[model samples]
Target: MAGVRISRAAGALLGAAGMVVPLAVVTAAPAQAASCTTSTGPYQTRVERFLGRPVDGKQSAADCKATQKFQAQHGITPTIGYAGELTWRTMNTMLAQRAAGKTPNAAGKCPTNKGRIACVDLTRQLSWIQDGKKLTYGPVPVRTGRDGAETRTGLKKVYWRDIDHVSSLYNVSMPYSQFFDGGQAFHSVTKSMWNPPGSAGCVNMRVADAKAYWSLLRNGDDVFVYGRKPGT
Candidate 1:
């Protein structure tokens, strides 16, 4: 499948444009391709079940394509249009959690003091900008740091804004970055990054949502991050 193309120098320049601080390179591995087959297996069965199909454990071209669609929608990586072991496991976890429930925590942890703030509930994997109780935007899907590198919680402020920020550490594009905590920003990442493998420490958003955030938020706006990621 096709991936974003950019030279090292170009990436560095993008990082520099964002005034990124130098840091150790993140050693996370890129997404890998998995083998596909038409044979039946537990993994295939789970995928079919999640898709509301007969639990026959059989793979088909149509099934593979449907899996790819699911992967893309959820930001799964190596979306090879097939239901591999990793794909099945990720889907199973998400299904087990039933994470799409609309309600956030009843605690209302978001700060009302600030005129407009970004509220990120890691537990729901959702975020929104609000003016006190009034909703301005969101509750959009987000991907936070995985097990090894959990995104820091608590209150923060939008100290920086970078429309074309690149990770100096990972040499990866981090578009529409709004830096709150040090080295941990809210930015747009590839949809594939949301699947089996996850972010290093940043809160990942879709490109359109990130752009919307950029437009809604201003420098020094309050940002509240609370709750735990589901299925961690």
Candidate 2:
């Protein structure tokens, strides 16, 4: 390591291009092999039940793989096949979202009087479209803005839309974008919506869901966003 250093005189040497540049060397760190564990987590049984595996609460190689796959699908961290709180919560949210499809607006939380509208329930991380009390589209799971950049709540309208929109700020593909709020819209991302630290104020949806939203909603359609996302 000591011999790797360059003296002041040699620090700025002329390159072959005739440009004086810093003489520096960098050594890449060795990459460690990813490991999988069979150690049972606290929520092992719960996870096993959710996955329809044996509810013995014991971790096996197959169980690890299954859990790891779930973690990766949901963008859970570490992806080491652990059935921790984060993973459990994601599972629960998914269950709730599925259940919501049946009676998405049963609570009468969103106004059903609107002719055709999109409703975003931040608390449940769900979105759905309705046509005067008739459920038209989802009660699908969504990823909302996280923490400081929380998705604003209020009644808004479909202000703009771009089918193959590229975000000017983030420089990412925002397909099937239906903008209802300022910089916030309903769009599709390749990422798992269940992933944490959520989206940048937009309602991130799965590919199919977004396509459905694009087909059902049009410009000037009412959009009502309310409630607060859990863990936001």
Candidate 3:
């Protein structure tokens, strides 16, 4: 009887050992591949909408590439090559405003003399050069100031033209600067002005647009800024 009891105890112990062995072996095995889900995040949906995609919340490879491209143009960092929260927020806001037709128009008459003038529509974030009633240049995109640092609206004259000017206050390179209202000027910027946190009262433009403005207008040219920048 004693021998039978000992045999039974030993069998039970062996069964427990068997279970532990497999568990340990499974734990020691190599990890599985990363299962990147197909389901899209909320930010990804916003990005897709901004990009004119179907917005099905599918995180395809192409979607990621497009997001990366936008981030690169706007000088957004990390360049993760993916549509994350920050990328989505910036792009969505800009596109929403544009879709709502909040930008300014170029139909109105130039406020200054008929010789040559630059008309800036703050609401539309557009600027153009006109020869009185005739439109010569553009409705080019521009970046203006934030809430407290609003770009002054009214008639202004380009007092200085600095092709390679550097801002003394911010120490930033302001290429093709056409200073009109005090320190406020039309200059080139690498950062994306479409999103929030705009310039410091100056009119920020693309490098090409700023160069074009520099060539079209001279010092003392009239710069009429009208309308109000949206969200400011």
Listed in order, each prediction's TM-score against the native is 0.66, 0.78, 0.62
Count of residue pairs whose backbone atoms collide, per candidate: 2, 0, 2
Please identify which of the two predictions, 1 or 3, would achieve the higher lDDT against the true structure.
1
lDDT winner? 2
Tell me the lDDT of candidate 3: 0.64
Cα lDDT of model 3 by residue, 48-143, tens digit: 878877787778867766766676666554554456666665665566446534223334634645468898777766777877666677667787
| lDDT (C-alpha) at residue 223 in model 2 | 96
lDDT of 1 by residue, 16-99 (tens): 534323222233464554544455545777788888776677777777767777776655656665666667766655553355
RMSD of every prediction? 7.5, 14.1, 26.5
Collision pairs in model 1 = 75-191, 76-192
Sort by lDDT, top down from the best: 2, 1, 3
Question: Which portions of model 2 show Cα errors greater than 4 Å?
Answer: 1-33
lDDT of 2: 0.75
lDDT of 1: 0.67
The candidate with the higher TM-score, 1 or 2, is 2
| Model 1 quality (TM-score) | 0.66
Model 2 lDDT tens row, 1-232 = 0112323432232111122111111213433424677678998999999998889999998888899888776667778888888888788778778778668898998988888999999988999998989888878888888877788899989866778766433445677877666557788876777888687677888899999999988989999999998776
